[model samples]
Target: MTRDDLIAMLREQTPACGPARNALIAGADFVVWDGLVPANRHAGVFRTRMRRSLKRGRTVDGLANSVDILRRAGEEPLRTGSIDAVDRSFWFMIFLNSTATAVVACFGGRRPITMESAGL
Candidate 1:
């Protein structure tokens, strides 16, 4: 969808949804899922990091769980990555899945949220 399309959806949908995890739907965008990490400069970083970590025998958190929660709460996964941007909390984007046709959510909170969006 176009930027206008995203903004229109945000305007109409966000207010109705209200706050989630202390988040207000700041905005929305039509974007590709990138998985780059340590500086997410690529779209495939989501899958890549997940795969790499798993290969190293790391126990990944239930990322799918987080996605499910976000979707149920009316959000879509955009760029998945661990960012220090949330005051010790990790952040990820949910760009309003097509079903909702609504606003995107940047889901984050103390403790590791989930790795589903973080994984490839």
Candidate 2:
């Protein structure tokens, strides 16, 4: 899919809430980790990274969960390589938490595309 397509997909899947309750990744050069490498996930999305270490934020984990959903849906799998982490050993991932279920997507590099999805 194209960058815009991916963004749309994420946005559609994200949930909307208050300021910090929104499902969006804030940064520049946002990309999704499909595996060991950083592949171009979607364009027009935020893409930011940590120069010193990765931050443990809700958005980061959310993005990773989205990736996992894609994989489980028979789509291509995404993963965080050594570069998308603070230690270059463990893979960074995102997840979605709800009252009933939780899912682990994949790790992403840089910033994530700000998306507000409500499973639309």
Candidate 3:
């Protein structure tokens, strides 16, 4: 898929809360990472590094370090012209918290629908 397509998929999958709550969802150029690394190929290594760093909490420095580790893997699975295990895993790491939000935005409105209002 194209970059725009990837962004669209992410936007659709990301829930309207946490970091994406009020921010415009757009693809930032992660020159050091993004398609430069095959996340799936080095999932174990990356996960280990990420887990270690995140143990200090989700600070900017920690996330940056994690991204750096992924970057070193270089493009392969990500550059294959289709979404693969690497892409999915990397996306999951980046968007995990936002996925926690189950609240969908109100139809044609900015307000987020409450579970009570939705009668769920």
Candidate 4:
């Protein structure tokens, strides 16, 4: 899908609460990451690494809500899209599988109070 389409879709999603809400921010770039080295899984892999790294905020509230948005658009299998992080605080991603399922990941910040999640 086009960048505008992706942004629009993400905009309608359940945004993060508090100041860092509105996951879709101005000047952010939306891209299809299905072509890089690890293919569509690039963001996911990094998420896994982050989960294993300094912080793993999967169980925390407000973090894992983005995946619900991704799952809603899971009809397109094996597709992936990512939103460039704004303010170096957070980035969002959506990955679709062959089973017509999708997962969204949104994370930001560095060390200490980092936010990470892959909502189902």
The candidate that achieves the highest lDDT relative to the unseen native structure: 4
Per-residue lDDT of 2-120 in model 4, one digit per residue for the tens? Answer: 54444444422333322222544455555665542322334445535545653643442223444344344434345555554555445555543433133333433322342453222
What 10-residue stretch in candidate 3 is worst by lDDT?
100-109
lDDT of 2 by residue, 1-120 (tens): 233433333333432111111223222123343433222341112233321224544344334334334444442223431212232222333332221122223334333333532223
Off by over 4 Å in 3: 1-3, 11-39, 59-76, 80-120
Q: What's the true lDDT of residue 48 in model 4?
A: 57
- What local lDDT score does residue 26 receive in model 3, on the 0 to 100 scale? 38
Per-prediction TM-score, please? 0.28, 0.24, 0.29, 0.41
lDDT of 1 by residue, 1-120 (tens): 444543344332332222222232333222534442222222233346556756876633433333334445432233332222233343334334444354443332333546764463
Q: List candidate 4 stretches off by more than 4 Å.
A: 11-25, 35-76, 96-120
Off by over 4 Å in 2: 16-27, 36-120
Candidate with best TM-score: 4
TM-score of candidate 1 on Cα atoms, chains taken together: 0.28
* Candidate scoring better on lDDT of 1 and 4: 4
Query: What does candidate 4 score in Cα RMSD to the true structure?
Result: 8.7
Query: What lDDT does candidate 2 reach at residue 105?
Result: 35
Clashing pairs in 4: none
Global lDDT for candidate 1?
0.37
* Local distance difference test values of all predictions, in order: 0.37, 0.31, 0.32, 0.42
